[model samples]
Target chain A: MRVRVLYFGVLKELFACPSEDVEVETGCNVGALRKVFHGRMPHTAWKSMAIAVNQEYAGDEVLLHEGDEVALLPPVSGGAPGNVPWKKIILPSPRTV
Target chain B: MQIAIVREVIDAGSITAALKAGADGAVCVFDGIVRDNTRGRRTLYLDYEAYEEMALNQMRNLAEEAIAKFGVRDIAVVHRLGRLYVGESSVLIAVASAHRGAAFEACRWLIDTLKKTVPIWKKEQFEDGAVWADGEPFPEEIVRG
Candidate 1:
């Protein structure tokens, strides 16, 4: 089966392309697919990437079919106002308490 | 009308206006801009990219969830794509409600949630080099399951 794999951010830079068609065995799972995907890119590229099939995050054992839109998502930096991550911080001791 | 992933500059005025309606006491607007520096590094610009289909799906879901959870009357989320210079806004959100508290809280939750789950990525270019910004890790539940 062939999967249309998409890349973004660091993954795109690592793979040197935005997307490509990947060939894999029929009945292959995402975990198995990772092996083939990683082989085509630099070693470090897969360290932090998460796999998404057709937009939803997929677990390692998720079965992949032909023509699936798979993406290699890198560590994201927050974009837009509604696109930021939250950080927990301990504040300096307060005076009013 | 409520969610958009655009390449053009974010129009805060229009977005804010879209959320305003009669009887709403306050409209809270949250804007995320491209600054001149990051961690003391001089930033030249930023490039944003997204898994458009997934991003839009996630964003609209978040907006609906915010309305249900926060009881906000209206909410708008807009994220910009492509190259952006310093001082430009990359994201903007507007929330309105009959009271101020829900709008403010919803705005905060919207940004926080979007950062973690929306499939958007940003690359920061600096004077010396460029790199992708490190985002928060996915929650254990999402990552493990």
Candidate 2:
């Protein structure tokens, strides 16, 4: 079987490409596929990366089928830091009566 | 709910205005902009990228979850891709509800959750060099061994 694997964030820079097609065993799962890259790329890079099959997060147990769109997601940093006000209000301590 | 991943500049004011309803008492908006600096380094610009389809899916899920969990009346999440100069709106999130509390909570929750879960990445271009911004780790459930 073959899957279309996508690279995002630093993975794209590391892989030197945005996406590619990879050949895997018929019954291969996400873990097995990850190992294939781990063998070639720096092991540390794969440490925080997650897998997405057909645009949804997939666990290692999830089976892959041919033509599946797999994405390699590095940790995400999307929105900017929000200026949310402090949640807890500080009150004066009660004086001894 | 309105969810989208667009490459063009995001119009924050219009989107927030569009999410308002007669029954809603408040509409909270979070407009994420490209800052001119990162950790004291002068930033030239930022280039954001995403697994487009997956990002859209994740954002849509967050919007839906915010409505159900926070009981907000409506939501709109829009993220921009490609190069963005300093002060440009990179993302926008707006939430509407009958009261201010839920609106604020939902808006905050949506942006916070989206930062951790969404498949979007930002590359900061500094005056001296460029580097990918370190991302917050995914939630434990989303990571696979």
Candidate 3:
């Protein structure tokens, strides 16, 4: 079976090329897919990353299906205001002691 | 005025065209680009997947709210759905207002709300591997207040 894993934000830097399809073995779960990705980039901290299956957030235990559009999202730098579009607000840092 | 998740990269010209006759005193455009690196790894590109219907609806809702709450004149929010290369425009936001302050406030409000309410997820493709963003989870309560 094949799964199309999508990359965005800072996570794209993990691959030589962004946004391509990946071929996985049959009966592979989300965790298994992460293992394959980990093999490609041994330095990646997969545990901190998030996964979404078919546009919905999924856990590592979720099973993968053929043609599943999976995505890997990193921690967003900004906050979600809920009533408006997302914005990045930068504040001044305090002086070091 | 329009909200969509398009496969092609955002067209700046289209955005400008959309806001032409809206009695806008000020127009603000924001372009979100793909950075070259994440953490310690080098990136090749980025891919964005969105719950199309929900995302569009949410974007519209955000726009409407900005107009009502902040008195925005017009707005256009377009985000790329498919693959995007480095430095390509992934997201474009244009907000127009009768005054500059309201326009800025509304634009900020629109983008800030879209991040939380809109069901769009972005994935990162690194040189070593790939990962999924902790995207919007569905089948849950959606509070619009």
Which candidate number has the best TM-score? 2
Ranking by DockQ: 2, 1, 3
Q: What is the alpha-carbon lDDT for the whole of candidate 2?
A: 0.83
Worst lDDT run of 10 residues, candidate 2 chain A, spans A83-92
Chain B TM-scores of the candidates: 0.96, 0.98, 0.87
lDDT of 3 at A12: 56
Q: Pick out the ten consecutive residues of candidate 2 chain B with the lowest summed lDDT.
A: B126-135
Best candidate according to DockQ? 2
Interface RMSD of each: 9.1, 12.3, 11.5
lDDT of each: 0.78, 0.83, 0.63
Q: What is the DockQ for all candidates, taken in turn?
A: 0.24, 0.26, 0.06
Q: Looking at model 3, give its docking quality level.
A: incorrect
| Predicted complex 2: DockQ | 0.26
Candidate 1 on B2-95: residue-level lDDT in tens? 8998999788997898778898999999998988876576878878888898989989999999999999888889999988988899989899
Q: In angstroms, how far off is A95's CA in candidate 1? A: 50
DockQ for model 3 equals 0.06
Q: Name the lDDT of candidate 1.
A: 0.78
Checking candidate 1 for backbone clashes, the offending pairs are A80-B91, A81-B91
Winner on TM-score (1 vs 2): 2
Candidates' RMSD to native:
8.4, 10.9, 10.8
Each candidate's number of clashing pairs is: 2, 0, 39
